[model samples]
Target: MEAMYAFFMDTAGMDEMAAHITVAVIMATIMFIVMALCAIIFTWMERKVAGFLQSRYGPMRTGRWHGWAQAVADMLKILGKEDIIPAEADKPYFIFAPLLVLLGSLLAWAAIPWAPGFVAADLDLGLFYIFAVTSLVVLGILMAGWASNNKWALYGAARGAAQMVSYEIPLLLATIPVVLYTGSLNTQDIVIAQQGGVLNWFVFRDPFLFIAFWMYFIASIAETNRGPFDMPETESELVAGYHTEYTGMRFAFFFLAEYANLFLVSMIAVMVFLGGWWSPIPGLDFAPAACFVVKGVLMVFLNMWVRWTLPRVRVDQLMHLCWKVMIPVTLVCVVGAGIWMMASGAVG
Candidate 1:
């Protein structure tokens, strides 16, 4: 036990091995708890927002005028669900895929710094870690699809894989401007560079980047599998896409992951193009970091707004929008940002 303890201490860079173990457990618990909280909030918000948009009362019976406890009631119902497992299903993978998706999404939150020095891990490759961890989730979706052995599942998974892969390329490229200017792969470093104010945001550094922000936002929406790019789960089409066979707690896991991922990607966009935790206007050194929270929450609401507002695109149109339109435009913007940086002496 002493030898095993020493080995982990060396690897975790901890003088005490128990601390390393404790940290991991705490981080995981925090992730689950926070994600659950966000999911509850999202459910309530979605109903109210939908009602507002449609000019009707959404949920008036349960709690207040809008039934805020609806999510809690729904959770109780989901927990009571029978937890069905198909006889034809590839049992283990079918049972495990939703957990994997949820796990991956929750873990990525470690790298996100919501407020001053509040990140879980301050790794130098924070941004890279996020990108790497998130891409594996597509494989989890594919697992759910294939394991279900349903044709609609297969089609949805295939489309999701193709769509995610195509959109990721532009999503990655559009980040070049943020990283190039910040000159660090650390997510916090990127946020810090934008802290001075609106003028100081990397997004406003040049005209190319100004255009790049919109491009990145669109690409990120597709990456998150939100509309108008939600072809995978088109109820009129695939019937819940990759999670077609999932039910009860398993299906609930996927829903939790989706909302968490939606918020994560929105936060990333906030950090990159919207100055992260900084207030919109400059010169407010006394501003509370909670202001950044307000900004990020607003950004998430904007995403939910778009989802409810827009119709899902055709699969082919989705691909065409990414490859033909967004890709080339982003490429030009990336190169233009670089050139402008050089010519204007922003880079040496």
Candidate 2:
């Protein structure tokens, strides 16, 4: 943020406050564009990936080249569709729900450092701020479900709320090991701690941190409401889940937010566990932001791969994995990481 502020002030001849505001607006716009692009690209990739997994061609017609323009066409179609609100629905909450969900996902990007000195807000509590803001999606989900006044929407919302709330525990627990090793919650600091090479990445630093990474990855999929744990929007059961009554652009906001959160979680994994923006080979760093994006893209691919390969788990099974299996395993990881650090004299 300081780097951006200085650049703006020096080049644009702006006062401190003006430069600050300009930088904020630019960063926000960049984040929005990135999220929008992710939705477009990932949706297309999702189809192609599913097709490959299912042994068929996906989206080969829309743009005449394997449907490269399919997502764009879908976006345009959705943009022109009529905005419909259920006659019996609570109008105010229904209207506000998608915006709230989108806002939740967008707000977290401010604290994410794309590369050294390139963050929008380099706060000491970057990770904590991310966790805090992203939780707003739950409120948005509840609003969408209850506001729709549909039983399926309501049930989906209930399950989503339960699933997200339950999984957050292990998710946070899993990252605690990283926090312990880095001794800071600042996202950039965490990345800096693992800067040497692939071997120094937290996942390879200690056996326990490695376990925590997978736990974090699994919980992230659940937190994003991806398949195998997509209890909130089970199409076969909930008809479209919490957004069943949403239409047109209003529904698009929810879709946009989902992909935004998807990339956000993947980037978080990259930053926390995969050595954000740093090339795996030591002292050969170049194109830091590109490195970050490539690593994040790989994480996103892993997520999509898992989504298509696994069957959605039952609601009870989801809860069992979170509470019974993941929670205990992550707890062990936290303890083991701390002890390992002490034994190695990394900390007192």
Candidate 3:
């Protein structure tokens, strides 16, 4: 951001404030477009992956090569559909809920460190900010369910609120090891600390950090409402869950936000545990941003694979896993990581 601001002010002869604002808008626009494109590509990849796992072709007719245009076609269809509202619904909250959900996901991208010095918001507490903003998703989900006045929607919302809030504890706890190691909440600092090679990545640095990685991964899956942990949208039980009454573009916003959040969490995994923008093989770190993105895509593929392969857990089981199992395990990881750091003289 500072680099961009300098470029605008120096090259375009703009005032400092004007340059700052322009750079901010540009970064935000770029983040939104990148997220949209990820949604499209990931939607296609997800179908193909599910097909491969299930021994069938998926969307082979929608595009010439491999149904590359299927997601685009769906977007076009959604664009042409009418926006419907329930007559009895609370109009304001109903209208605003999806937007709020999407905004929460989109805003987190601002803190993502795409490459060295390339973040939109390079705050000292980027990771904390990401967690804080993403909790807004629960609020939006609750509003969506309550405003729609549908029993299934309300039930799903309540489940979603409980599940997300429960999982957040372990998610933040798992990340604490990384923060302690790096001594900074800046995403870039975490990446920089893992620069030596694959083994230097936090996931491989110690047994406890390795454990922490999986803990973070599991908590993130639940946080994003992905399958096996997807209690909120269990079709058999909730009939489309919190968004049951939504239609057309409003529904599309929810869909887009789901995929966006999916990629966001996967990207965070890459950034925190897999060494963002750094090649695993030493001395081969060209195309840093592309390397970062490819790692993120692979993480997303892993997420889809897990989703396709696993059955949804019962609600009680989900809570048990989060509160009883993952929370305790992650607490152990945090303590163990601190002990390892001290014993190895990595910290005092």
Each candidate's TM vs. the true structure?
A: 0.92, 0.98, 0.98
Clashing pairs in 1: none
> lDDT per residue, candidate 2, 146-254, as tens digits?
9999999999999999999999999999999999999999989999998989999999999999999999999999999999789899999899899899999999999
Number of the top-ranking candidate, with lDDT as the measure: 2
Candidate 3: 10-residue stretch with minimal lDDT: 1-10
Candidate 3 C-alpha error for residue 336, in Å: 0.2
Best by TM-score: 3
State the C-alpha lDDT per candidate.
0.82, 0.93, 0.92
Colliding pairs, model 2: none
**Candidate 1 local lDDT, 1-348, one digit each (tens):** 234455567766676747557666776687678789888888888778878877887877777656988888988899899898888999999988887787678778888877666677767988778877888778888888999999888888888889988998888888888788889988789888887778888778799888888888888788878888988787788888888888899989988988898878878887778888888777774653576657767877888788888888888899889989999999998889889989999894
Q: Residue 224 of model 2: what lDDT?
A: 96
In candidate 3, position 253 carries an lDDT of 86
TM-score of 1: 0.92
Judged by lDDT relative to the true structure, which candidate is superior, 2 or 3?
A: 2
lDDT of 3 at 295: 94
Give stretches of model 2 more than 4 Å off. Answer: none
Q: Over the full model, what C-alpha lDDT does candidate 1 score relative to the true structure? A: 0.82
Clashing pairs in 3: none
Clashes of each: 0, 0, 0
